[model samples]
Target: MSARVPRVLAIAGTDPTGGAGQHADLKSIAAMGGYGMSAVTALVAQNTEGVRSVHVPPADFLTAQLDAVSDDVEIDAVKIGMLGSVPVIEAVAGWLGRHRPPVVVLDPVMVATSGGRLLEPDAEDALRAVLGLADLVTPNLQELAVLAGDALASSWEEALAQGHRVAREHGTLVLVKGGHLAGDRTPDALVGPESPEPLVAFDGARVPTDNSHGTGCSLSSALATLQVRHGDWARSLRIARGWLRGALERSAELEVGHGSGPVHHFHHVQEALETWGTVPERFSDELWEVSAPVRREIEELEFVRRLGDGGLEPERFLAYLDQDLQYLDGYSRALAALAARAPAEEARSFFAAGAVSCTETEAQLHRARLRHAGLEGAGAPAGEVTRRYTTFLLAATAAEPYPVGLAAVLPCYWVYADVGRHLQELARRSDAAAHPYADWLATYADEGFQEATRTARRLLDQAARDAGPAVRERMREVFLEACALERDFFAAPAAASRLPGVVAIEYS
Candidate 1:
């Protein structure tokens, strides 16, 4: 028999707006790579702003929905959210006791993102009873305080303390989220009675966006899906947190509702058409889209402007070229390592060819420059910036996964291609006469190099699409770091002084 696709079930309320409740859960489950089924306990009259009212189904109907699904289809995981009344909570808890799923992720949806009450005060006791049935209980600081019957958690320390206390009381794992805490970082800790230390801690830089309406529901659903896939709670939380962050990063791009909008759960999908122009394909449109700030800095650099105008002194250009050549030496090896680990034959061949192309391209540029500078057999050592960048590349190749290594090496190809093409276009439009660096700029901006970049992006995208949340996030981190390094490498030559041996001579 064929292996079954993991079936993740969500028992929650419905939002007509499709931003929260069962709608958000289904979206998150599918995005995290799982088949989703839902049984509605309540129908919430809600939008992005707040919940107007909730209509709970009868207890027997809720039980019937659960039985209908569990009777035929095998459930791999279950995520419970927004039990509006005591009867619904008890009914669900009763179902849980009989047909226990392999994994149960409970999002204690006591409060909404818009500061509205989702669960009634009378339902709190029933919700508490339901907690012990869950594998993990995810609660924001406010929700944790309510569940633990304590004051609000004002700090991360207090949040952890509350989590530990609640976990001990219920004999379950409690995920205390610090997203509401005032800080630059958002920290979440999973604590239980069995261990003094936290089972896992997930920390992320706070994404500055208002489109976080369905965050709790999304996270809980993603956790259920990931738990089914990896079968390890800590690893599942790590990957789920990463995916949630990506969703938040791209949330602003989605236009869902008037108030705090919903996050873009499928933000990592490849674009229908390539919109990068001369810069090549991007692994995830979200990665490239979020790189605008760095790209702006590179565009405004003095070194880039000088190169475009052909006003850069030949000595400085040579020094930059020398550093670049040195950088390429290590870069080629990283490409070979990536090829060796690539999951597909097509990706393997692509990376292998990339290594060969790097060598040939670097050699040709160095040969031409050496002949022009009257140095036939001399080699230039790598500069500090070049050494650091190549070191990072080599390490990524050796240690990180294939997709991550590809991301680390991507900026070198993309940034250079973009800068080269921009400079070439500038040279074409500007009235600069007989530019010395014109041929060099033309070489890098050629169709050959552009095609190579396109190939690299396509391979990286294939890997990224197939990778899980944790690896995809790793790819993003590496891509940003590499892009930052690219900015430094471009700026290094302009910031540093002239070469020691060569005399300073500015061309008109």
Candidate 2:
């Protein structure tokens, strides 16, 4: 809870253009509220126009630079950008092997925006060998094609398969960016060997701008900060991608460079927004009124206890899962409906991913409950239903080109933790049959899940500080509905506890 700054180490080539590379990465880290440290791999004399000259740092010096930063500073995350040749890659890989940092983001930068090559002939092999130690690797379409020895992915399925293949081979997570593919829209896939499926994509509209010079470097750096702040690299990528989208949107009006220019890295920074919380320039009484119930419910919900104990009871879990499946179905439909408004292909793809996830989760839940008698045949696709709510909330987010999708996801995190705590307290004094909450406490109690729950809230709150009041107000709206849904979800047994249908004391 203490106010502290996160420090990220960016190891990459520097661009005089300041649009992409080490320079852009540093700016992105700072812009996202993290302190940035750099170990230059190469220095390029490049402008928005393109690269003119490149200067490589000797392997030994690169080694010294990496060592000095790790020894002197408390590094939270590391972002690897362009490395000119094999020696530089080996030096970085050697240093990283020794340090064994927890969060390392490897951004494969081989093809530049101007169709210029940045790495030496042997650099690819060396870079791959050195970067085998990365926690995550982000590669654009061209890089993926090169890595796969295929000129094009041929299909979205191929892109995902290739990304997963490389991620597994490297023993790290792979983020395959579809932006460079020929299309008005692009989709990116994030996959690892450990996940359940390779198709769980983070779809976003690939922002169209010639000013997208430093995108890869900036994204990796931003992801590094999120990784540092929160251990999950997936969340970091989601945030970074969304943050980059905002940066691109804001920079569309600025004339930073004559050719490709730079994105507005400082876009979400709300220091310039005159209004703070509590005192809004355009305050609405309706907003406060609608949000009051949610605030009260949140105050009443005991998140810690719900997480600590058995969480949701078997029956309640079944019910909640059913409802969630229903929600996701609606959400998928909503996403499809909203696709026409998507600013880029990535957003449309992300919505598709969300739908796919919802459907898959619904199937998983349905199978999980198949053994149970009364609930076996009657379950609704609840995740789909939840999707409706998400899509409705997303509608409020449509006017702006930001990561409102991630924002819409916040309620799921905040509400569950809060309601789980409250639910757990009720479970503590009651027997299994008497309590409505069960499987949830065990589910939420896991250290990994708990950490995720906490980090997401912190990130969301930070996002709110700079978001427009309308957005904040919309967040409150969705949160209120979330509270109601949760309350209704729990209200079933609590309200009908004494009824014979409730079937109390059945646990023999």
TM-score of every prediction relative to native: 0.55, 0.53
What is the lDDT for 263 in model 1?
Answer: 89
lDDT of 1 by residue, 296-371 (tens): 8998898888888888777767767766777778889998888898888988898888888778877667757856
- Model 2 stretches astray by more than 4 angstroms: 1-4, 194-196, 270-508
Write down the lDDT of every candidate, Cα atoms only.
0.84, 0.66
Candidate 1 steric clashes: 0
lDDT of 2 at 215: 81
Write candidate 2's Cα lDDT for 1-508 as tens digits: 1136678888888787677888898899998788988999988888888788888967899999999998888787788988888888888878877886767888988967866688886777777675468888888877877665566687777888788777767777888887777666767678786652653477666676777878888888888887777776666667787888888877876677788778889877554743664444423233336656765655454432342344534544455445555555555555454454445565556555545655675446554654343545224433333444555555644553243433555455556655555555656765555343355354545565456556545544555655676777666655566556554443332221221122441210
How many Å off is the CA of 223 in candidate 1?
0.5
RMSD to true structure for each model, in Å: 14.8, 18.8
lDDT of 2 at 72: 82
Q: What lDDT would candidate 2 get against the real structure?
A: 0.66
